[model samples]
Target: MFEIGDKIVYPMHGAGTIKAIEEKELAGQTQEYYVINMKIGDMQVMIPASKIVSSCIRPITDIRALKQLIHNFHHGESDEVLPWKQRYKVNSEKIKTGEIQDCAEVVRDLLRMNKEKTLNSSEKKMLDHAYKFLNSELESIKGITDNQIKSFS
Candidate 1:
């Protein structure tokens, strides 16, 4: 369980801090919720304690994992050969997992594809979203500004 001030990444929504934990009544039940203040978009999200597991809320990654992710991006190659429809489905699933490594893979593959050729509009949008999600987490963990993030790419 996360305490107030703990940073966490909400799947597909980017990273945020636990600003407060509050009890509220909904559907004739009183339940505890984590009030997350998102780092991007000036947004806030309230996730229920009971649903935390299924909601895929997770703590920010450690430095070791971040280093490994950067290594993979620099040294790995993507073998995404599925048709566009199938590839989109798979990439979407990976991004939804909210795993930084998986999200990085999606961004790497999409960026690679873009270099080879222009991606369809949908794929471009997906790439942007995945990159934003991954970069937001990286910024929080690494304490880097947006300008510094580009140097990693």
Candidate 2:
């Protein structure tokens, strides 16, 4: 249901712009696909229309929703202390699945952990990636600079 030029978030892939809609022959049948060009990097993705809904692709959050996420980041409870390996596994899956709320949870959890102790290199990278992805959408939604968003950190 997305039109050309619409901005959408692709799970794990961050935000992207719908570059075009085209029909192509596949498996002896013609099908339509949305060509999405990533906003954060140089990459294009083709998604079948039928699969769009199931794919979890969605528009950027509104200001209110973004604020709620920020509030969650600021006030959310911490995860119980777990083995780093196990925590990394859970957080990694949340990032890969590209669910915004889940990613927020990971960010909140990691931030809390970082506040308590130093994170391993891998954990630091995951935290950075999650921050980048969330910050991009939040900046766009608020029409603010990345620095402004960083002030919320």
Candidate 3:
């Protein structure tokens, strides 16, 4: 279970530190929720404590894991032949998973595709969001820097 001061990643929204855990009443029911101070966007989110697992809220990946992810990103190949619509759908789902590796793949694949051909506006926006989400989490890692994050691209 997460507590105040624990750092976590909320899928699609980016990473944050748990600032508080409180019980609140809504719809005549009282439930515990985690108040996260998001690292990006300077925002806060109140996530239902019971839904933590289902929502894909997870701890920040360690530096070692992140290094491995970066290595995979550099070596992996994207499915460039997939139609844009199909590719969009797949990438969107990956971003929703809140997994660092999946998010990195979305950023890497979209970037590689953009280098070959221009991505339509929708894909361009997705790339921006994915890149920001991945970078925000990377920033939370102790020794990583924006330069290292950019090198993944």
Question: Order the candidates by lDDT, highest first — what do you get?
Answer: 3, 1, 2
- Compose the digit string of candidate 2's lDDT tens values, residues 16-38: 88999999999898999999988
Tens digit per residue, CA lDDT, model 3, 7-40: 8999989999999999999999999999999977
Worst 10 residues of 3 by lDDT: 144-153
- Candidate 2 local accuracy as lDDT? 0.81
Candidate 2 residue-wise lDDT at 95: 83
Best by lDDT: 3
Candidate 1's residue-wise lDDT over 47-93, tens digit each?
88999999989999876675577778878888648899999999999
Worst lDDT run of 10 residues, candidate 1, spans 143-152
How well does each candidate superpose onto the true structure, as a TM-score?
Answer: 0.92, 0.86, 0.93
- Scored by TM-score, the top model is 3
Q: Is candidate 1 or candidate 3 better by TM-score?
A: 3
Poorly placed runs, candidate 3 (over 4 Å): none
Runs with alpha carbons beyond 4 Å of true place in candidate 1: 142-148
